[model samples]
Target: MKSALKKKNLVVLKVKDVKRDKELYLHQREAMMALDQSIIDKENNRFAGLIVLPTGGGKTETAVRWVLKNFINQHKKVIWIAHRRELIEQAFESVEKNAITALIDKRKHFNCRIISGEHGSASTIERNDDFIIASKDSLYRGLHHLEEKWLKYHKEVFLIIDEAHRATAKTYRKIMESIDKNAKKFQVIGLTATPFRTAQYEKGLLKKVFKNDIVYQVSLRTLISRGILAQPILKTLQTYINVAEDVSEEEAQLIEKNDTIPPDIANFISKNKVRNNRIVQEYIDNKDEYGKTLIFAVSQTHAVVLNTLFHERGIRSEYVISNGTDLFGKGIISDSNKEKIKRFKENALDVLINVNILTEGTDIPDTQTVFLTRPTTSEILMTQMVGRALRGEQAGGTKNAYIVSFVDDWQNKIAWITPEKLYVGQGVWQDCENNPASFRRLLPLKQIEQFAKIADDTIDTTELEKIEFIKTVPLGFYSFSLEKTNEDGSTFNKSCEVLVYENNKTSFEKLMDKLTAYYSIPDAKGAKKLAKIFADAEDLSVISFLASFGFYSSNDSPTINLIDDVKDIVSHFEINRTAPPYIEFKEREQIDIRGIAQKVYDMELGGKKKKAYIDDVWERNSFLQAYFNHKKLYFRKAIDTELLKLEEPELYSA
Candidate 1:
C-alpha cells in the first residue's frame, strides 16, 4: 500500500503543470524573425552574435520556428548544434512541434532529421535534411572530416549554436571555422543565459572567435516580474563550513593547484557555515516541505560524489554532465540517455545533481531548491544556477526559490544580489574589486536590529517568539538567514540566507518573518498529547516531535536521513559498526585496542611471511617476515579457518 501511494504521488508530480500561463509574446516572435533575417543576411557572410534569452523564454522554439519559416521558402540548410546530449535531444524534441506545423504548411516538406551520433546518418556531410539537430562533438567531428562534394554543395547553411557563450571554445570554433571557410555563406548565432568575459573571454581567442555582437537578451527576472514566467522567491542561505586548519590548508592547495573541488567540501562547509549540503539535504529528505531539488555541483567528479552521497542516504537522485568526443568519435551521452534525463525531470525525482550541463537550456519546473555545492567567481554562474530553481511557483505560495552556496572559499569574489535591478536584462554588478565603490556596503548594527524588530512586529510576534529557537544569522552585509523545520521527521536547523542591500535588512527581515509564520503550522499537530507525554516522563521524542513543527521563512531544508537523525535523537550517539574516526575519538586517552587486536591477528595469520617467501628465497627470513607482519597489520584482516570451523563456521565454512 505504501509503495503504491508513493508511486501514485510520483505520477501526479510528473504530469502536473505548475505554471498555468505558458505563452510567447510578439516581441519574442519578432526577435525570432530578426534572428532569421540576421541568419539569412549572414548567409551572404558569417556574423558572430549571441541571443541572451532567459531559461524557458522559448529560445529553442524561436530558433526552430525560424528554421521552419526560412527552410520552406528558400530551402536553406540549418545545422543546430547543442553542447550536451540532453540539450541536443531536447532541441530535437522541441523542433518536432514546428515540424508538425510545417506539415500543415504544404502537402509534403523538406526532411528535418536529428543527425546525432545515435539516430542520424553515419556521415553528416551530405544530409538532405532541411534541419539537422546535432550534438556539438558529433557535428564537430563530421564537419572536421567533410568530403569535397558535401562542402561544395552546402552553399546556404544556417548554423545555430545553442549555449553560444561556449562557442568560443576550441571544439565548436574549429567546426565553425571549417563550415565558414568551406560553405558560401554560413550564419552563426550563439544562445546563452549568462555571458561575461574576463580577459580570457574578452581580449583573448574568444574575441577573435565571436566578435562583439550580442543581438538580444530577455532576462529571467524581467519575465518573472512581468508575469511571463513564474515569479521566483529568491531564498539564499550562506552555509559556513568549518574545516580543521590542516584539512583547510590541504583543500586550499587542491583547489588552487587543480582548479577543481570535491564533495568532502560539504562536510567542511557544514562544519563551519551550516551543515552537510546545508538546507539542500534537508529538502531532499523532507518531501512534504520541499517539492523537488536541483543540486549544481562544481565539477563532474563532485557531481558523481554528491550523487553517491544522496544514494547512501537513500534518496533517489540523478546527475547530468558534459560529454566530449573521444578518439573513436563517440558521444558520452546518447539520445536514449537524454530521454532518461527528460523522464527524470518529468517524474519528480527528489533531487537532480548536475555539473554544468543543465545550467543553461534544460527546464525542470518543480525544482524548489537550488543547491550550490561549488562557488564560482562568475555572477553568470551564480545566475545560471539560480535560474534553474525559479521555473514555477509552489502550491504553498512559495513564489521565489532557494539557493544554498558554498562560499567558504570564494567569499570575496561573490557578487551581492540587488533586488532593485536583478531582473533587468544585461544589468549585472560591475566588478567591485576592480573599481571601488561598486560593491554595496553593510548596514549599521542598529539598523539591522531595528529591521529585525520591525520584522518581529509584522507577523504573529507571539507565535514567532514561540518558535524563536529557529534563529537566523546574517552571512555578511547583504545576506540574511531564516531557519525552518517540519513535523514529518525532517529538520531544517541551518540558516536561510539571502543576498540583498544592507540597508534593506528591515524589508528582508519582514519577508522572512512572514514566511516563518506561514510555514510554522505543523502538518500533523498532536501537540496536546505530545506535551502531555513530555510532561509525564520528559520524553525526548516529545521535544523532537515539537521540533518537527519548527518553522522559519527560509526556502531550503536538509532531508533527515537515518544515520544523522539516529545520532541526533538516540541517547548514546555512536556508529554501530565503529568507523575509524569514531573508535579513535572515543578511546583518545585509552589504549589502542583495535590496533593491538590487529597486531595479534597479523602475527597469528603468518601475515608477511606468506609474501616475503616470494621475494627473499635465500635469507634466514625471520627479520624480513617480522617487518612484513608489522606492515601487513595495518591493511589486511587476520583469519583463522580451523578456529572458525570449530566455533561458528556453519555460514563461514561455505
Candidate 2:
C-alpha cells in the first residue's frame, strides 16, 4: 500500500512539473517578440518604450521571461522598479521562480535583491547582484547610497518599471535621470495596464521619458476575445446616501483638487447603518454568485464594520488594513493582513474586505467579484480596484468577473469614476446578451453633468411641474422650429433638423456655411449663379450632402436632389414640416445652446482663450449662430453667467 501511494505521489508531482512548463499565451509571446525586435533595432541606442497589456494579461511575467532569456542568461545587470512593496516582492519572486527552472541556461547563477523600506537597503546591494527589485520610494531616498555602493561599478544596466503609468512622477523621473547620467549603456522598458495619463503636461512628460514609443499594445476587448482576460460585468447598487448635501464648499474644493474623498465624508459614510446594512445584505443575497469576493471600503473602520457584519451573519470574511491599530485600539500588523490574503487566495475565506491595501500590485486572480463600497475621483485608483477580478479562464480564473459598484448619490459634487468609462471604446456594447441596455449606451459623464447644470439654469421649476419633462435631445442631433415672416407678411413656421454624426462640428460648420451662403442671396438669378458656382467648383450634390449630414424629417423628404438647380432647392426649403410646439422647442433649444456654451467655457483654457474660442465657433458655425440669434437674450445671459462663474466663482456660488 505504501509503495502504491508513493507511485501516485510521484505521478502527481510530474503532472505539476508539466503544468509549470506551459508556454506563454499568444499575446504574451507577441509582446516578447516586439521587445526582442526593439532591442535589436539599434536605430536608437537608448531604446525606451512601454508594453501595454490590459490587467490580468501577465505583463510582469512576459517582461520577466524576456529579461531572463535576453539579459539574465547573458549575465547582464537589470533593475526592476515598482512603486509598491507588493510589486517589488512580486517581481523578485517571479524572477526567482523562473530563473533556475525556466531559463535557457539553468547553470547560470544570479543574485536577486529587494530594496524597500521593509526589505534590505542600498548598502546591502553587492556588486555581484545581477537583479535588483526595488520600490521607487526606497530607491529615491537611497540614490546616493546606491551610487556609492553598486551603481558606480555597473555602467551598463537595463531598467524595467512596473505600473509604468506613474513613471511621470518626480521620484521616478529623478531616479531615471540619475541612472542616465551614471550608466554608459542602458535601455528602459515600462510595463503598464494604462499607458495614457489624464493631464496633457503629464502625457508630454511620459512621451519624453518613453521616447513616444508604444512598442507593444493590446486592448481590453482583444484580451477578452482571446480569453486572456475575463469579460467584466459592471453592476451598480444605489446606496441612496446623499453625502453631497453634507459637504461644505471647502471640502468640495479639496475633493475636486485632490481627486480623493475627504476623511470626514468617508467617516460619515462608514458610520451610516442603513448603508452598511445594504452592503452586507447585497453580499448575503448573492453569496453563491459572488463566490470569492473582495470589497473596497472607504476606511479601516468601514472594513472592520463590514467584516463584523459578515461574521454576525455567519459568513467567512476578513478585513485587511495597513499596519495600524484598529477602531477598537487593537494593534493590527502586516502579518495578519498577509495571512488573511493567503486564506482568501486558498479559498478558505469567502470574502476579503480591505481599505486601499489591495488596490495595486496584489495578485488575487481568483477574485470573482469586487464590491466598490467607496467612491473615488482618481481614475488610476479606480482602474487598480477594477483590475483585481479581471483574470480570465486562461489565466486560471473565472469566465466572467462581476464589478459590483455601491453607488451613492453625490448630487454632482464629485465626478466619481465609473467602471463603464474604462471600456468606453472597447466595444462593451457589442455584446448585447452579456451587457444590458443600461450598461450598453451611456452619454459621457461630463456631458450629463453639463446638461444637468443647463437644466438648473434654464428650466422653470413651476412650469416644469405642470408638464411631464421630455428627454433631452440626443447628442449630435439638433432640432429647431423658426417662425418666419412670409413674403406677403403672413406667418409660417419653418422646421429644421440637423444630424451630425458623432458631434462632428467641422462637418456641421461646412454644411452651415453652404446653407448660410444660399440663404443670404435674395434674388433667384444670384442664387442660381451661386449654386452653379458651388456645384462646378466643389462637385456638390444636394441630396448626397444632406445624406452625409444624416439629415431627415418626419414631415417631408427633400424635393431637390441636385445643387445645380436653384429652383428645386428653394422649393425644398419652402416645404412645411411638422415641428415641435414653438415654446417647448425654444425652451429645449435654450438648454442645449447654453449646455454647449458651458462645455466650451469649462475647457482648461485661460479666460481670453476661452472667449476667443467661443467667438470663433459662433462666427463661423451658422447653425449655432442661428440658434443664438433667435434667442439673443438667453444667449447673452448664458454668456454673462458663465463668465461670472469663471471670473468670480464665489460670487457666482452666492
Candidate 3:
C-alpha cells in the first residue's frame, strides 16, 4: 500500500504537469511566474492552499507551470490530488513533457509516473521522484493500510487539488486533516473556476481550508472581448396565460416561498402547439440544422423525467444523473468510457444531456442550442451554462446559438450582469416585443381543460391532434364579470372579456361589442344580467361576443367564467406604451450576429426578397435606402468589407 501510495503521488504531479505544459496558451506566463515564486518561497515546508480563477480562465496550466519551474532542480516528490481518475489522467498528460530520461538513467531522479486508480500498486519504490499524480479516491482507499515507511521518506510532498470547490466537503477535508497530522513537511494548493459554496455547505470553511486569496481572475466579459471565448445571446419563450385559483393554498405558499412559477407556468410554456411540439420534435425535425442540443433542468429528477419524455417521443436523447440508489448502475457513464463519450461528442446521439455534469469542465465543442427549463439566480451558473454554446471554431460554418428560457427570473439574472458584459446583441430588456416574431396562441390550462373534457367524453382524436386544431382557430375569447369591493364597503363591479386571438390579432367586431357592453355596464345589476345571458346560452354567448372581434380561447363556450378575479383585472386594463422585451448593445470590435448572418446570406443568395430574419438590418437598411437611395444593407462593398473583418477575421487580411 505504501509503495502504491508513493507511485500514485508521482503520477498525479508529473503526468498532469506535462499535459498542461503542451496545452497551455497565450498570456499565462505572468500567472505561472507568480505561482512559481510562491512555491519557491515555501520550498521545504508544507504548502496547502487555493488559487481562485473564473470559469474558462486557465487555472490548470498555472499549477503545471509551478511544478516545472520549482521542482526541476530540487528533484523533490510532488503529489497532485483530484476526486476522479479522468482528471488525474488529464493532468498527467498536461505535464508529461517535464519527464526526462537523463535523470532516470543516472538514478538520481525520475521526472514523473501515473499511478492507476484501478491498480493500487502501480508505484515503484524509488527515491527523488520529481512528480506524481493520484486520484483522492485511490489515496483514501489505501490510507489506513499504507506502509509507515513510505510516509516517513516523502518529506517534500506538495498537494495540488483540482476542481477545488469540492475541497470543502467532509471527505476531502478529513483527508487533508489526516495528511497534516501525519506529515512533518507537506504543502497543499487548490484550483477551481467556481468555488462559491452552496447554501448547504457551512460558510467560511472554504477560506479556512485554502488560506490563499485569489490573486488573479479573468472575468467572462474579458474572455469574450479578447476572442478567447464565445459571446452569449439571450432570448426567451414566455407564457401569457392567466393562472387558475384551483390550486390549494399550501401549493400556492410553496410556490411563493420558492419563488418558482408553479406547474401552471410549465403548462403555459408547453401550451403553445408550436413551442410544445417544437421542443419535443426539435431533434428529429432539425437534425441537420441543430446537430446537438443540450437541455438543462433544475434538479436530477427533472432531468430524468425530461429525458424519459424525449425518449418516449422517439427522439434520440439521453439524460445522465449522478446520484440516488435507483441510479446505482444506470446512466452513470464511467469517466474512462472514452469511446462512448467520443461517439456522443461526434453526434452519434442527437443530444447528450446531463444536469450539472457537463456544465463546468466537460468540454463538448459542437453544442449549438441550450434549452433552459429551470430558472437560475446564480450569475456564475448562467454564464457557465450560456458559455457552452457560444464557442466557435475558425471557418466553423456560421454559428447560430439559441437560448429558450422563460422570461420571469431571466430579467433578475440579467440585472446582475452588465449590458457591456453581454457578448452579442445589446439594447434594453423591453425591446424584445419590437421584433417581428410573436409566439402562436396556445393557452395551456384552458387548452388542457378542453382536451381533458373531450377525452372524458370518449373523443376520437388524440390530445395532440386536438391541440393542433385549437392552435389554428382564428380567435379564442372568454368573457366573465366580477364584483370587487373596496375595504370601506362601497362596492364596484366590472365585467371582463378575456381574449386569446388565433394569431396576434387584436381587432374583432364581437370583441368590440363585449368591450362596448363592458363599458356600458355601470353596476352589479347590469353585470348580473350579462352573467344570466352567458349562463343561458353558453355557446351563443361566446359566438356572439367573438363574432365582432375575432378572438377566442374556447370555440365551444366563450363565456366560461374561469378565474373570474383574474378576468376582472384584465377587463379594467389601461393602455401604456412600455418598452419591448429584449435589447442588446456592444462596441465596434464585437461581432454583430444579425449583421454577419445577413451579409453571408445575401452574398450566398444574391437577392433581397429571400432575406433571412435580420430584424435590425431591415429596419435600419430600409431607412438608409429610402432616405439616401444607397441600398446600404443590399450589399455596399464597404459594409461587406467591414463585416468580413468581423465575421471572417483570418480571411480579412489587413
Q: List runs of model 1 lying over 4 Å from the truth.
A: 1-22, 25-27, 36-49, 55-58, 72-75, 82-90, 96-98, 102-125, 133-144, 147-149, 163-185, 194-215, 219-221, 229-385, 392-399, 406-654
Cα lDDT of candidate 3 equals 0.46
Cα displacement (angstroms), candidate 1, residue 500, comes to: 25
lDDT per residue for candidate 3 within 61-84, as digits (tens), equals: 567656655654355556677755
Error of 2 at 12 (Å): 38
TM-score of each: 0.40, 0.52, 0.38
Regions more than 4 Å wrong, model 3: 1-27, 41-44, 72-74, 84-132, 144-149, 181-185, 195-204, 234-654
Q: Residue 627 error for model 1, in Å?
A: 49
Q: Residue 457: error of model 3 in Å?
A: 20
| lDDT at 367, model 2 | 90
| Candidate 2: pairs in clash | none
The parts of candidate 2 lying over 4 Å away from their true place are: 1-26, 37-50, 72-219, 248-260, 311-316, 325-349, 359-364, 378-380, 426-504, 507-654
Q: Kindly indicate the candidate among 1 and 2 with the higher lDDT.
A: 2
Highest lDDT: which candidate? 2
